[model samples]
Target: MSNDFFSTSNRIKSTPFTSRNNMAGVKKYSVYNNTLIPTVFRSLKSDYFHLIKHVQIWDVCCQKVIEVRGNNALSLMKYLFCRDFSKIVSGKSYYAPIVNFEGGLLNDPVVFCVEKDHFLISLSDSDLFNWVSAINHTKEFYADVNETDILTIAIQGPKSEKLISKIFGEEIKFLKYFNFKKFFFNKESLIISKTGFSKQSGYEILLTNPNNGILLWDLIMEKGKEFNIKVGCPNMIERVENNLLSYGNEMTNKDTPYDCGLGKFCNLETEYEYIGKSSLLKQKQVGFEKDIFKIHFNYEFDDQPIFFNNLPVFKKGIEIGKATSIVWSPKYSKYIGFLIASKKIMNNLNDYYILDKGKFEVSEIL
Candidate 1:
């Protein structure tokens, strides 16, 4: 393994569970929203295997939340993203992809309707606070947008339900996927959501009291011993193999929701006046040059593939697109990743190459 630097200061804040992560002997970390988030606890292959079979806890406090409340909060939400929020059901968490005026993605967050005028936007690794605050500053909408202090933790895997039920009771196990409800744990109330960053069955607990952080962690850890729960974070190998796109990696400000294979989440036919509706409509009418793909390599890489940025992909020695994320999947025993290929070779992915040598086996995800 290679050594990379991760320095924390007053600017790069630490989560409430940072000390516990250290005690767990965390191996690596990735900075999200100017906060330290554990990337690996034990090892990549081991963590991935464990996450698929057993349960694991994650320090996801880095998922900053922005609260938009008031009468016109619905109008402001309509102007934010292309997702149709007019028919949002109660007790449901929505996956909203926020975009700028140019139809380019700004940030994709999970939104919860706290009330009719009150909504909490759980963000994903980007500074979306300033954008929302600035837009609502015009006073066109009578809404208040502020950054909230919400510390979040995730319990993920196949056995997550059993582990969470030990403390929160069996009623929480029935909360529908992408749904949330308030549950009591001792005296403190935890906003438990049946949502997580992994493909496994899991839940994210939001702790309002920072003082309750370690106590809650210890309780879960103690009770979870029977289920073999271990400290873990978002594993790259599992995410890539499952085609779970990470913000700032799989998609960025340079691409739109459509370009990143998130078009179905958008509603262009609806008459909702969103920020980039026109741009998205025009792009859809004209067509995009690239889209994301699920891919694999013909050659077996000896070491784990750790990519910092998108690697240039080529076709017959000509640059076609880039491989945004890559990892050596131990289960697949090959390099599986996501590729954004140009329209010319997007349909014919067999001719794609990464190092000007090997070919790619691309298939449609879902």
Candidate 2:
């Protein structure tokens, strides 16, 4: 990959771009912080409601996909995860946490079932390729794995059904969440899945060619004109309210899936053994000291300036917990944030006060 592949611009512009095939002109936007580009795109609204009511498209190339193929792929996956992939059917998806032996979450990636024998792992910010390599280092495993650079476009909103129907027809409407269907555009095969980060209904198109990315983007925007379509990224307010956790924000390497409130997804029912099963089983029996919880704060704070408590929130100067992501919900007309605190502290909810710039009592917990 070349550094010149990415360039900065003040406005969205159409330029000659190269994909797996050849040069195809596509429109690109130059964003400030590359990490925030996804959120920024979703913030732009064409309707009165914060929701992207009509339609919206995203060039989420930043989220890379790694494909694992060849014999023993399933076995390798079985060794790497606690999720029972054996039950996953082709064209479906499963969400699981890839953990180490000590039960630390390495990366929370979505495992997509492209075929009974092959799979694609979608990663957020972590380098999944390195993780895959580390798994392969155990010579006892027999599998061929390769990582591929892929680009994806997310088409979301209520009108998404109608717009996608025009291209793929009414069959697409039946595609269940976490399910995918394959279609051809310009004689090239593309996979579209009924999944996205937003709680709202949507579809994501995976394309190998970058040129096709621009064409699909333009086509959706053009066709979406009647639907009052807009271009944007995933809705932050909607995601948080729905309890959809992001990678680095809600969970990290230091946190186990159980601690992050994803313990239900951890499957201990399987006869086949996995890497972190022992630790997870032990944690389950012993119970966790802290658990992720949704907390509503009673305070007014600016959204831009990342707010942090001035004094360490404590029970008689003994720290109990700290706040994570916080946002003011215009719809709910209240302040909401996520917190990881001692189970003892949570038991006494009335005593817990969030020190958001100043001390404020916790209004409620969900």
Candidate 3:
């Protein structure tokens, strides 16, 4: 890779863990949420194996939060996302899918209940921050909406509990999945949640104090050495195998939840009004013409495979739909990826093929 591939500039901000990531000799970088995120370290394959076996620390500060507080905070939450927030308890989190008025998928973010009337929309790579701010200003709701400086550090893998217990004590293991609690580290209050990007059991610590970023990273590395912990990023192959969808790749503003295989997350029975409630109800009734599918490439390639977004999906020379975010899966021994194609083609998987340099079969629907 050339230096020009991802040159450093003022426009592309660096996270608090940038220096630590450089010390780890990060191999590659990817822009996420306008921040430089470590993509690879030693090697993708080696990192994947280590992550599954041991544990690794990930600097995911790029998972920015859109903080909403004040009297109408809950109102704003109900107005934006499709998930029913009626049952959301304090100190817990829920995966909420934000959508446009037309029911197009805007962004899928995890909503954290910090206080009785306070919520944090920990977002993926999208400009939903601006959208939220605009909505707050226009609505004049009794709520304050602004971006918070809560940096997230992820300790992921099987031995994640072992590593976290050393610092936070064994009681840290008691936190249930998708639940978060405030704890003291160096007498400074911080939030740790049993949530992560990978399917593996882990936790993401939200550091309110920016100064503790390097200290926390160094402590984890120092305490984690006995566990053979390594610095790594989210593995592409592992995420694909788990059917984890990536924003700006698997689906975008042009796509709806139905098209992206996220219909189950949408709450249609709720009587409370949401941004796209009516549109989503209509979409649910009419049904989707296309949906997401997993593709498997037959040929082999040593280098990383490149997928052109919206690559034509063909069936007996007739175009049905398009593919996006195709990645080679070493675990499955094939190039597997996510794509959106006609429901007809997805149902009759024996016929459809992804048109790339060569044809690849639509392996599975997940």
Candidate 4:
């Protein structure tokens, strides 16, 4: 709610999404670069959910961009990923999931193919930077990797295309999904990619110069006057319907890429040596467990209590699993959520009862 939160600079603030340690009350995860606004779950769910359905500008600089540049950039990346980046041409962006040695999902970051030798990895959280740095320490690859807290702004919603088209001209409309094009504003170079969190068309603009962050934001707001633009973040309800995976919610390093339904992004055919290629291949060949499912509530309850599944799900008094991301869809008027459980429980979806404030039978499958 504070405009000061959006001010350009590195300053971390604790919110509901962040947790504090008992003795010192220290926050577990600090929003890096400090300039980005930290919108909490409850605030986003109640106040801004409907507002974000319209167009809005968000200071996502905290999302951060890590630059991997040098002669050996591609070769270095090959050693870290299962995907083959050798054919990844310039001016393209790809949604690739970073996996560990056991093919577990580390982070799902967007890889921007800036040029044949230069690549930019846009991270959702700070973990990606540490992972990249850790890999570099082993001297397993030869590339210069530097982490930069570059400013990133997401202009999302239905009218986003119009607002952007006006600022950068009609040329932006030609840029396909996951494709980026360099443009100049006040002679300052910026990268605009046709990508965002909403199901509606939008763009994520990367400003190399932090000084231009406010300038770019102001210009967009001015031009967006007719579009009814309201500054907001990506809503969970919208993302859930689209089946978009939230970083910490859907899957984590504990879950393998195959378990999270991201196996397609793992390109095992690539000849390059990667971190956990052999382990991943072995898991795949031996047949790993799969628990991809959608859980629905049979009846509605109070908004607050029904928002999250606080009780443990059990079959015959045996704990199986718990719910992850839950959202009440305004569009569907149904409470839907994504849950991870054993393959046995997942296969018998009908028997599973999602206990909210009250018991709601599993209404549908994803």
* The candidate that achieves the highest lDDT relative to the unseen native structure: 3
The window of 10 residues in a row where model 1 has the poorest summed lDDT is 357-366
- Across residues 1-366, which tens digit of lDDT does each residue of candidate 1 receive? 112446557888887798888889888887899988888777788899999999999999999989899989988987887899888766788898889989989998999886778888999989999889888876477598989889999999999999998888889878889999988766888788999999898999987787797889999899999999999999888888888899998888888888878888889877768888998888888897678777666454554345325566666777776776777777776667787656657666455355434444433222
lDDT of 4 by residue, 1-366 (tens): 233334323355322212111111221122443433334433445434544546777556666678998887887777777667768889999888788877777778888989878889887653777788778767656577888756678888878888999999998889999999999987988899989877777899987765576677778878988987755666667777677877777777778777777777878778777877888888879776766666666564454543563345555556666666776666566777776666766666566564542366667767
Q: Clashing pairs in model 1?
A: none
TM-score of 2: 0.85
lDDT at 2, model 2: 16
* Of candidates 3 and 2, the better by TM-score: 3
Clashes of 4: 3
TM-score attained by model 1: 0.93
Better of 1 and 3 by lDDT: 3
- State the weakest 10-residue window (summed lDDT) of model 4: 19-28
The residue-by-residue lDDT of candidate 3 on 1-366, one tens digit each, is 314457777878788888788888888899988888898898877788888899999999989988899999988888888898877799999888899999898899989999869998898889798788877778777588889899999999999999999999999889999999999887799889999989878999998887787888899999999999989888876787788898898888888888888888888888799888999888778887678877776554555553334566676777766666566666777666777766765676665464753445555545
Instruction: Assess the local accuracy of residue 327 in candidate 4 as a C-alpha lDDT between 0 and 100.
Output: 69
Per-structure clash totals for the candidates:
0, 3, 0, 3
Show where candidate 3 strays beyond 4 Å.
1-5, 300-311, 352-354, 363-366
> Model 2: clashing residue pairs?
41-232, 41-233, 42-233
Candidates' RMSD to native:
2.6, 5.2, 2.2, 5.6
Candidate 2 CA-lDDT value: 0.68
